[model samples]
Target chain A: MASAGSMAAAPFWRAAGMTYITYSNICASLVRSCLKEPYRAESASREKVHFSVSKWAGGKPEKPNFVPE
Target chain B: MAMAALRKEGRRLVLSSNPSSFARSAVFSEESCPFGARSVSTQIVRNRMSSVKNIQKITKAMKMVAASKLRSVQTRTENSRGLWQPFTALLGDAPGVDVKKNVIIAVSSDKGLCGGINSTTVKVSKTLFKLTSGPEKETKYVVLGEKGKVQFLRDSKKSMELSVTELQKNPLNYTQVSVLADDILKNVEYDALRIVYNKFHSVVQFIPTISTILSPEVVERESESGGRLGDLDSYEIEGAETKAEVLQNLTEFQFSCMMFNAVLENACSELGARMSAMDNASRNAGDMLDRLTLTYNRTRQAAITTELSEIISGAAALSH
Candidate 1:
């Protein structure tokens, strides 16, 4: 019952909707992956494991005994 | 009136006589033909480059996504390997019984373009059907994916239970499998339960693994592939629960977990297969584009040379 004009437009509308849906799904998954760690910790009440913070040795003496005047 | 009519006819005749020459003069005139060809070809090359770059960007993003999924799935598969071994071993230790009624849950991907992952599972299922048929034997099917459901319904002579979950979209959750498992447990009665799914071996290769869940005797028997499942330990009596309750829970839990694991493994296989397929497609597209550009260039060059010869001839004709 649709006219030719509307029929031609239908495919474009459908394609636009599909792309939007796909993008939204991908975005939602990315967001979920991002917040997964925090969500897991809060739900389980599990203790957080910490990693050792290492410091590098001081490079060279600021004054190398031959100081610039 | 005759002179006016003659002049009009003369003009029409002059126009008709030099149609090609007029077109040639307009298009390939004093304006350098090489310049036109060079500019047009450059624009085309630039356009193609941008499109190819866009494709590369998209493919790179997909590759990264596939890698992340592959990592998580591999970890889950390794962990479940330990779980399936003990559960299957326990079943093996159960009393042997004649399995006349068989229900095989053959899992395949809903989506296509996942290489041979689905086909391998189908092949194994077909083999299972051929091997298990006899005069009085009854075999049923519980198909997990759309593809498998359709295929079995068309070709399979036995009754099949199809489970389709709404949550089969991107980032699949455990609910899909749980729904399927519940439906399967409720409707069908089969002495032997076997599941055919792709077991992830590597990125390129996933072996079709068919594991028998019911008829504990089959579980006890080592697989033809000679993969030995370690011996099962006796159930330790926990504080409050009776052995009967525990065993019942364990059985349900094991089945649900196994189904869930199979679906996840299938998803991983599907993605991996698609990723590889797309990778090849993108590469082929690049190759095609290269060939097209070369052809386009050659066509443009030949056009320019023809134009140059025409202009020279036209100038010579004008001088004469």
Candidate 2:
């Protein structure tokens, strides 16, 4: 009842305070980033964000942008 | 003299076509054409029509773009659904969670012109807000995407806790969504999160969906009231208090997975909606363009016929 991938990843990623989706996506993107030029650009474009967000607390505006990760 | 000649020619044609209603037809024509310069009106219609055609061209292009991107987004959404369904199956989806403190996370897009996807999410969130608030029960809103935030600020300003936007301006990935989920988790601590978003069924169909995730303590209490956690007893745990911590971790992870899945679904639906909306706009523009062109042609022909008749009458006058 134990697969190596599941046994190793499920606990580590869950312990990192992240979900399986995050783990899979980060790994997938990490692999994509390691690829050659055109492919790397193609993969990076899929995850890029182009806008800023503002936070409001009880009708009072706060930070214009939260430093993007 | 020319006036009499033109009247006589018109009467002769109307008499030949419909002998009985000739007088009424002449009177109707007199009443209808009170203004001259029909060519000027036709020119205005022609200009407006060309503008409509330009708009149709742009909408057609937009429709093609949406259609092209839809396949990839749809595939992403389908794959992402797997991430949350397993979690939902494990941790019970408490549909109507009536907790003291609940936060409604409404998902939408940053841009507009994609039909009513955003409004529908907001509507569901607002309706849920109304249902979940009372004397002791506290209900707040955490709006995801800027469109929802603008609507929330319009009237439901006081209830909004956090608003995130610009997530859809570029390509979407799970990492960005997880970051957003973490940001929300850090700021807002509530008994449950009622996540509302649009679910993409197909290109032309998307329905509003709401799923509730309870906090660790609530889930523990829920296990006592009812074993809605169908197969929860099979899993082994070390201690009693540790169960809450496990559930806590599970709840947080579940939130991240759910948010990632929801964002992908919302993006897919947005593109699908844009496709249909732009298509409809293009079709309507084509119809209007056809009608306007027909009107313009008829006016141009009428002017030509009148000029020919005047020439004929003047030639007749010169010969006499």
Candidate 3:
């Protein structure tokens, strides 16, 4: 009794072997994209995932660099 | 001469009293009494006044922070509602059902100072636990957030199966929440999953809400049993060999959507509660400040009157 049974044979994302996490993330991003200006920008920024990256040289370890999304 | 010596002793005592120590501050009643160490304790009262002022400042700042965050969080909560409401509309939400395996996911906030948001969920969850617990029935607690976890651990530690804390440190979105939902799904199996969270009503009000997501088999049974899923007759299933497969995927996705909305709404309610809590705290601080200032002034007046009387008595003694 779930919604969208009449539409496509499958939900398409599931047919493509996407996990529920990926499917839901795509749906959420699509929703986020439809928001008005400032809010859209704010949500976009909040969703960004930043990481700290470091590369070791031949001898000592190199300085860590912050990788921005 | 004896009176003069007593005056010197009082001066030495006042000087020896720690001016910035609130722990030694005299109560307002003790300060008003015409007796022991009245002047000595006024300095401690001054210390208490400053500590209260600092508390007022912190609470005021927290209120402002919560106010600012509330707007964005509220917007997101409203948007995420669209994700789960459709699922409820189609599948029909589960009512009070006695199930063999029940998983109760109680959403709570990590930070304190929010009025009864955490306690409300804990209380509701506790009630649910009591109701669903019996000889054949079992209830497992899946508490989300540190606040609820600490309280749940106290008495209901044995019933708790899983706890996901510190989720509040990151921004809440469907992406983040889905991963958590997936993690929960992987770890716990249930016939009926009941999510407990605070439903934001207004600035000063919120309700502890529990929404149920039944398994596909339970859904079919409920639908057959004249539940609200009578609309199931209208829809057709394809691509999947059986209705069970489609319902399975839909149920998992719906769970994620529901959890996402739950986290967002709980966050919004927490902020609203915090704003009001901090506002009340700041107002209480202002009242305390007024009373302390009044006592301090009275203590000052008493010291001045005593000094004047001492001078007059000494002058009279000299004349005699």
Cα lDDT of model 2 by residue, B176-250, tens digit: 776677677777879999899999999899999998888888887777776767356668985333555568767
For model 2, the local distance difference test gives: 0.75
In CAPRI terms, model 2 is classed as acceptable
Kindly list the interface RMSD, in angstroms, of each predicted candidate in the order they appear.
25.6, 5.1, 11.7
- Best candidate, DockQ: 2
- Reference-based lDDT, each prediction: 0.55, 0.75, 0.75
Give the runs in model 1 whose Cα sits over 4 Å from its true position.
A1-69, B1-61, B92-98, B170-176, B215-249, B317-320
Q: List clashing residue pairs in candidate 3.
A: none
Ranking by DockQ: 2, 3, 1
Q: For candidate 3 chain B, which ten residues in a row score worst on lDDT?
A: B5-14
* Residue range with the least summed lDDT across 10 consecutive positions in model 1 chain B: B224-233
Tens-place lDDT per residue, model 3, B1-320, is 64354334323323444422322245543456556643535767787678667767777888899999999899888888898888977886765877888999999998877878999999999999888888988888888877987888778877777777667665775566776776678767799999999988787889889989988788777777775776675688655446766677788889988998999999999999989988877776676677778778877887889889989999999999
Per-residue error at B68 for model 1, in Å? 3.5
Better of 1 and 2 by DockQ: 2
